[model samples]
Target: MGTVFLAHHLSTDPSALSPFALKVVDKSLSFAADADRRARWEISVLSRFRLHDPLHPFLPSLLGSSENADILCWAVPYCPGGDLNVLRHRQNDSVFSPSVIRFYLAEIILALQHLHGLGIVYRDLKPENILIQQSGHVTLTDFDLSRSLTPKKLDPDPLHVACSEPETDSDLSRTFTRFVCPRKKKNVNNQKGLRKAKSARVSPVSRRNPGSFYERSNSFVGTEEYVAPEVVRGDGHEFSVDWWALGVLCYEMLYGKTPFRGKNRKDTFKRILMMQPEFMGKQPNALTDLIGKLLEKDPTRRLGYRRGASEIKEHEFFRGLRWDLLTEVVRPPFLPSKDETELTEEVKKGGIDIRDYFDKLKAPSSPLWSPSLDEQRHNVSLTEF
Candidate 1:
């Protein structure tokens, strides 16, 4: 919820010279309480993966954190390859080939699976938050919007067993391995029947679902375009929401833009509620079919609703994928060039000391205090009509 900078540790010890992306939140802002909470929550979430044994290569582990009266700062490995969105734009057609999409999507699925396994729901899942590693593999970033829900445990069943079985796709060896290049657009009008316009986006929340292992939260929070229909309806949502977003991410990767986006925010919500995803210039395939199933309006009916990722892993789209070998693959779709991997000296200048940057933002006014600018504008009232 604040600015990120390429930074180096301020310590004099050379052993601590590794580069990090430092996120700083100014506690002097009007939304300081909420911002502080989100920052703390993210640190807690990342600590799990950072401290746990068998750390995930597809997620950022917290390097460190510091907070004072004026600012809060935390660091993670800096991704020089930028985000998936940047990579998408670098592609010749601004879209990825099917094989490249599959490669990236598989890693994302694995990342989400690990998060869900830890009882955390990654409420936000857009291309911007999917960071590329120096090795060209993907790592999920920005967990401040994520929610920690109670883990759901279902009674073991035969369908679950069958779905969890990983199949090998020989075709994967022959698939296109080229890496690709990757917004939300919104529209609003005074429609009579429109629901009161909340902010175009929502925040993540923690809630428990009764009589079900899949925790359901009622908080209205997510980027507008990627929000699941159940979430839009204010129906309590659970793990299935991530699957819906994964579908959106997959579609955007293949087409270079998000499906269901409309002229504005309200129009986008309407499309999300009523329209189907448009597949331009391509015939239907297992991938498209899988996207369709994941985007089903009814969360209970979504592709991964029952067995979670295991169900999607068994789909024809991923038929030949060697899930276990994903991390071992030597040739990924794209590798970040040396420039992207190393922090530039320009960024390192003054950025090494994170506290100084945020300290300058603190004001003499009390943290929660707001100046009454309205009082100064007595003669002019724009809303007088």
Candidate 2:
């Protein structure tokens, strides 16, 4: 829905840092109302984390925002090291080492744990959304797709909402069987992309505030590859979906690609429902076991479903972890070099004026870029970071 730009604030104070990423969304375009609400929601959510909190040290805090006129914009600390996706590409094999994965995943778990504590479910958890801070720590960006979901006893609906998608009993055993099978060999396209979506998933349109805290939403949203089976099946999902996505992210970090990705979205969704992740090469025992548990199709049986992140923290994979001192690790596996942090005069070099960009699209076309007439060609990314 918008573009991210490298920006800075002019300040006289030497201690006042200015460099940040500014995300601007134009609300005068199509789906204006829904887009406007999400923009406001993101600002509200980030403002809550603006204060320094040791528990949420890795999460981004909003610096400021402006909803003036037709544009909605906000500023967040810029990560000079770029995102995890970029860092992964820097590796010789486009994958992280076991030790590097351990350090990064440990910090991510803590960040997710803190989000769950605040009654928020982070729907988007992937390499792109995971930004690297200058301190060599990771900070999660983008909260537009996330919503507040309170923990409450799920009542049996007389309407039979729970029974709509009958739970598959034999699938659990089938999953275990597939786990031992040799993973399929990597194809040529795996080198360039971790996994790119061919099309955007259809999300429910809404003028209403994302349901109240006590309820659940059946909205089909989130990146196609990262979406959970529960979400794909359209059974009102809750906190467990995050755990499922966590499993996908873990698999990608270790293997350089998402476990269930296929030739297309249809095939990928089918794989998510019917197949299990196949580990290649020498498997990391604890880590592989942890991924299996997280990817359980039955949300109720998923590893972190009941007790949230605490259940995963106690798993054998994270044993001997020093959660408190994660921030103190001065020499993380990869740190942004001086050149990465150094600002050039052309930081905003190809940046578009968001408001004018939208205005020009609405005008009659000339030789320049214009909105596509073919319906299939137009797809919104819905990124409101």
Leading candidate by TM-score: 1
Kindly list the per-residue Cα lDDT of model 2 for residues 266-380, writing each as its tens digit. Answer: 7887777778889898556998998899898777578976556667877888888776677778999888998777665444222344565556656777333322321222211
Off by over 4 Å in 1: 10-17, 151-211, 345-356, 359-385
RMSD of 1: 12.0
Off by over 4 Å in 2: 11-17, 51-55, 153-214, 346-385
Q: Report, for all candidates in order, the number of backbone clashes.
A: 14, 0
TM-scores, in order shown?
0.78, 0.75
Tens digits of per-residue lDDT, candidate 1, 1-385, equal 5766555544542232466666778777778899899999999999888666667878898888877777788878877788999999999889999899899988898788778767778999999899988778999998888897864454454433222333244222211211111011122221223232363333222121213344567777889999887676555777789999999999998888899998988778778877899888889998899899988877757887766676788889988888878888887999988755654444444333444434443545425222333123212111100
User: What overall lDDT, based on C-alpha atoms, would model 1 receive against the true structure?
Assistant: 0.71
Clashing pairs in 2: none
